[model samples]
Structures are given as structure tokens and as C-alpha cells.
Target: MNPKATRWAKSVAMVATILAVSSCDVLPRSGPTKREIYAGSVQREGDAFVIAVNDRVTRATAVIPALGFSDSFRNAGAVAADVIRPGDTLSLTIWENVDEGLLASEGVNFTSLDSVQVDGAGFIFVPYAGRIRAAGNSPEAIRRIITEKLQDQTPDPQVEVRREAGDGATVTLIGAIAGTGVYPIERPTLRLSGMLAAAGGVAVAPESAQITVIRGNQRSTIWFQDLFDDPRYDIALRNGDRILIEEDTRSFTVLGATGAQSVIDFESQTLSGIEAIAQAGGLQANAADPTGVFVFRNEAEEVAAQVLGRNDLIGAQRMVYVLDLTQPNGMFMARDFLIRDGDLLYVTEAPFTQWDKTIAALTGSLGSVNALSTLAGQ
Candidate 1:
């Protein structure tokens, strides 16, 4: 070979060797690789506590969001529809055998007194039945009282009473429902589930729906599906109750060698690890290491103790859970494992990915060198 060509070859070989050796350490990546993570977390002075994922580990960490009803909410009883209240509008009709009746016209046998409203004192005044207590009594009981009082003036008189639109028997239905406004409590809609159905159900997915009942100073929330799954959740609604339905607001952060690196909202009340990965658009097949998936969280001291099987750890401890998809039970473990709020789910790059980057860097460096050599020769 020519001395010049030999010198050029030697220079190119030295440059390629340097580039290959430094590519992995200097190259920009989405996140740290598995080896880097292991090196950092394996030491006693490490910042995070890393645990291998398994059946027992999953059981220890499978926690659900806090959602349930208190006794004050679950035990709030209902009011009867027949019982009259202040501010109620009463419709009354009177009937008599005689053509000229006390409350009827000359030829008419029956007469209707339209919209006789109950006073704030819970009393209604009829033609002959003066100051009747219509608030505490049902319509049938009030009708009988009116008939007895009017019989002296108009013999064998009959009375009918009906209750309509009152401030006393209504509730406010708001948030993620089709019909959001004040609704009356009567007939078929006396319970929580019935009122929800009357409002056209939840506007979002059933799994993501959450219901809250606010009764004065007390407030309680539960999964919307739980109202039907458990009868105890479907407590009787009371007057002036405010019911709200909305989607859950919990989410997790996805990073590293996944198809997407972003914040993902939970799809349901109970979100599985596999479901969370799928929501992140899955792991990047070209660069992801199946055995290096990890979940990082700041667990409560009590939860940390349960997870580590040792009560010595104190305060809020940082935890990392590893999931190896290569094992036979790995997929099942992932399926059963639960993802929680504010968690970090990451997939590491394959070891070969670093080497590939090194090789590509060397080839690119050689290409530039060859072009420079040709220019010099010219």
C-alpha cells in the first residue's frame, strides 16, 4: 500500500475505535438503561428501593383508590311522596249529589279549586273547611277531613286532593349526567340509582364514573358502578340533597423506551399493569428490553413495610418494581398487577441497542473521513 493511503487508513481506524468506545456514554437517549438503573438502585446508599415483581409482591401493592360512603351518607333515610309540606301547591275537587252544591255551580255536580297553595304555616283554607292542616297529612287524609267539614253545608260531599311541584321534595342533579338540573323525588325515582337512571345515566364510561352525594356539611363519594353492584351504596335520597357524577381524575406517567412517553389517565377504577402499558401505546419493539420494565413510586411507610416484609423502614419510601416479561408467569403477573396514581412506568432499552448506536457512530465517522481524504487527493 502507498504510505499516504496507509497513513489515511491508520487515522480512520483510530478515529473509529474512539467513536465506538464513547458512543453509549455520550449518546442522548430517552432515559437511563436497565444496567444503569441496576447499578444505581442495587447499592445500600441508593435513592430508590427496587423489588422484584411476583405474586406476593403484587398482592402487597395491589391498592385501589379511596372511594366509599360513610354511615351518614349510607343511612340518610328518604321522605314519603304522600306527605305534604310547606310551599306545596294543592289541587282540590269537590263533588255533591245536589245540582246547587256549596262549592259547585248551579247545574254542575263537581267543582275544581285550581292551585290552592299551602301557606308557610302549612295550612290551606277551603270554602267550608277552614284552616286545614295539609302539611303533615297525606292527600287521602286531607280529602276525608275536607269532606267531613263540608257535609253540614253541602250534604254527602266528596273531596279529592293532589300535590304538585314543591321546593320541599326536590334535589339537584349536576355534573356528568345527560340531564343536569333540579329534579323532583316522586313515583319511581326515590333511590340513588333510580334518580341516576332518570337523569339519563352517566355521560362517561361506567368504569370511570364517580358519584358524590353532598348532604349539607357531609359529603361522600363512590364508584358509580358500585351503586348497582352493592345495594348498600344505593342509599335513599333525601330532600335538598345534591348529587354529582364525574369521571375519575387519577393518572400515571409513562417514560423511557415506550411507544409514547406522556401522562396517561386511568381507564377504569381498577387499572392493571398490562392495561397501563397498553394505554401508553405499548413498548417500543425495536429498542425495548422486555425483562427491564420498571414501576417507580413514593409509597407510604405502611405500604413500604408490607411490600418489603420488614417494618424497619420509616416515612415515605421510594419504591421500584421490576417486571420481567421473559418469565412464564410474567405476563400473568403484569395482568394481575395494579397501577396507581402518580406512578412512573418505564421500559428500558435492550443492551444491543447501545452497541448498535456505537457501530452506527463509527460508520458515520468513517464516511466523513473518507470524503475529506478524497478532497485532499483531488
Candidate 2:
């Protein structure tokens, strides 16, 4: 061979050797070892920080009377609606023979009498009495009005009114509760806890559930924890009052280089990335890559890749933040970065060291296949 061609061939051989050696170090020998990929792909999710079992969350407890009237009883006069519910028995009797005496029987057994139903129109049907407004009127007031109308035909007739079977009172329970339906309010006043207890309390996930009160089109949210904290928020439920329990949908999941991988729930409207990391029990000592910490999230079109280096964040307005485990001051910055739901955090390992084992395995497999083919051909 010519000297120049021989030199060129030697240079090519050197370059090929370098590339082959580098590939061996770069590619993992094992089929993409799970531990290696997990170390790089895992991230913290959600806003709220996770507390230890020994750590006590700030909570309040108060002793409330089991059956005492709530302060809302003062505004009872303002309520003007009523509805008959199950488990309540109402008795209806007519005075003398003015209206055919529906309730009065000498020997005949009657399944139904002249009982009035507070129907959809908020009125009750009485025999020969037509539709009379019974809703919003007390039992005594209804009796007085009926007596006045019958006074002309009967001489000093006695009128009897009693709730024998159905009391015109009901409460509706909706949202994040095990049983969401119309529950009967046996008594006049029902406390917030009493209603929850009647409906099997809040749903299984009480921490992520909220209660809403819908009365006369006015809606108000009541936090389960807050209801336990503040007595003022615990309201007295009235007839026809609706209690809705709403389940919280916002949450974050922590994976990869975190000490603990768990789904963290965010009750607040917003959560920071740094806060999410801390809630995940900080980063693992061996797997955490302080310089290569990144958050992989889906943007409008492409995946938004944000790098959080140790010195990148300086202000609070920026959503992305990098944490430095080596420095004490970085702890404060980690606390500042808010985490959002579905946000993924990845800590990359040092290059060349990651897939060395995988590449070696692949190369060995290729070499074995080539040798097997050569042998078979021979």
C-alpha cells in the first residue's frame, strides 16, 4: 500500500477505536436499567408539602352542643319555604259535615282522608276547599283559616289538625358525600355536623372534600377543616336546604430522585415546584442531580422543558426554580418555587456514566449474533 494511504488508514482506525470506546461507556450494558431511568425521569408533583407522621398539622377542635339551636335561629322568620318529607306523618280532620267530613268515619275504613299535600305549587288540595296555600303557614295558622271558612255552615265546630304521618320538612345533600340524597330533618333545627352524620359524614377522602350550602339560590362553600375550626361557619340547616360536598380535583405526584414518591393533594389554588420537592421529602442523596434538575411539562404545542440550575432563580415571579442541596441558602429558594399539578421533575445523572452497562450489553449481543451467523454460514 502507498505510505499516504497507510497513514490515512491508521488515522481512521484511531478515530473508530475512540468512538467504539466512547459508545461502550455511553450506552448502558443492561436493557435500560430501571434504576437508572427512574433516577432521571422521576419528579415531584402537586403544591402542598408532605408532612411526617410525627408532624402535626395545624388543626382546631371545639366542643359543640349535640342538639342546641344554632345562632341562625334568629333569622328563622325570614324563611318562607316548606316541603313535606318522608318519615313524617300528618293527620287531617274536617270540622262537622261542612266538607263531607273526609276524616270523620262512622264505620267505613278509608285509606286516605282529606289530607293536604304541599304540592309543587306550594298549595294543598282539600275536598270542596280547592287548592289552599299550606306552605310557609304554621299548622295553627292553617287550622284558623280553615275554621273561619267553615264557621258559616257549622255552629261552633271544632277543627283538629295534627301531623300524623308526614311532616312537611326535608333537606337535600349533594356533592362529595357517600350518600347524596334528600334526607328527612326530624327536628326543626339541624346542625352542620348533624346533617353530615345523617348523610354518612363527608366522603372517604374528607381532606380533599368541601361542603357547599345552597339556600334560596345563594351558594356558599364550607371547608371541612374550617368547619371544624370555626364554629361560626358551621350553619344550622333548615327545611329544603341543600348541602353539597365537592371533591377536590387538584393534586401532584412525586417520582424519581425524591425521598418519597407519593401523590400530594393541593387544596390551595396554586403550588410551586420547589414547594412540591420539599413535600416529597427532598431529593435522594445518591440520585439527585442539583445542576441538571429540570421540569418537563406540556405546553400549548411542544413539551416545555425548564432547567433549574443552582443559580438560575433570583426572583419570585419566575415559575421555574433550581435548588442547590449543597448550600444552606438554596433551601429558601426551594421553598419559593411553586409546584402545579401534573408537573414532572427530572434529575439527570452525570453523562457517560448513565447508559454504560446498557451499551455494553447491546454490543455483546450484536457480537454474539454476528459470530452465530458466521458459524452458521460456514
Best by TM-score: 1
Runs off by more than 4 Å, candidate 2: 1-90, 93-103, 107-115, 119-132, 147-172, 184-194, 212-222, 235-244, 253-256, 259-282, 290-318, 329-338, 350-378
List per-prediction Cα lDDT, in the order shown: 0.86, 0.52
TM-score of each: 0.92, 0.54
Residue-wise C-alpha lDDT for candidate 1, range 36-84, written one tens digit per residue:
7777673656788888898888998888877899988787676787888
Q: How accurate is candidate 1 locally (lDDT)?
A: 0.86
* Deviation of model 2 at 345, angstroms: 2.9
Candidate 2 per-residue lDDT over residues 103-122, each given as its tens digit: 44555322244455466555
